[model samples]
Target: MIWSLIILCGVITFLIRFVPLSGIISSDLPLSVKQSFKYIPLAVLTPIIVSDLSIMENKNFFIIDNFKLYAALIATLAALIWNNVLATISIGMASFLIMSNF
Candidate 1:
């Protein structure tokens, strides 16, 4: 049963990926479509980061922490200024680790 489920998932993944690359759909998209797709990463990551940064307790829910949120902010700045993936991730992770230790 597990093997069958794995095979099914693999097939589904293959179909999802393959259908996009195939000629069944038009490759040329409008400027609006491209612009919206470009913001997909930010749209997806913002909520997750905000949730992690926020403090949630029985009495208080609005408190912001020191480590993860600041690290993420610095990382975001690094990415914007440097436009480099490796540097952004390194700065983000390093800051997170360092701040977490304190």
Candidate 2:
């Protein structure tokens, strides 16, 4: 049952990711639809950011002492400054490790 559930979840995830691309590539999307597609990344990211910022185990509005949050912020800044994924991840991980020890 566990294996079946995992397989089912994997398939569903794969289909969701592929379906949009398949539709776009297989058919000529209308101009408005194509324009709207450009905002997909922002649409996906907004919910993730909202959930990360607002959701907490103890009903806290902010995670002030959260090392991961600090690390992520540092990473974002590094990415903005350098425009490099490796640098951002490295900085974020370094921040996380340093902050976690305290």
The TM-score leader among the candidates is 2
lDDT of 2 at 68: 76
CA deviation > 4 Å runs, candidate 2? 1-28, 49-55
lDDT of 1 by residue, 1-102 (tens): 999999999999899689879878777888898789879888998888777776554557754565777898889999999999999999999999998887
- What TM-score goes with each of the models? 0.58, 0.61
**Candidate 2 lDDT for residue 89:** 86
TM-score quality measure for candidate 1: 0.58
lDDT by residue (38-99, candidate 2, tens digit) is 89999999789657645465676567877777788888899899999899989989999998
Q: What is the C-alpha local distance difference test score of candidate 1?
A: 0.85
Query: Of the candidates shown, which would achieve the greatest lDDT relative to the real structure?
Result: 1
For model 1, the superposed segments whose C-alpha errors exceed 4 Å read 1-13, 26-35, 54-59, 62-64
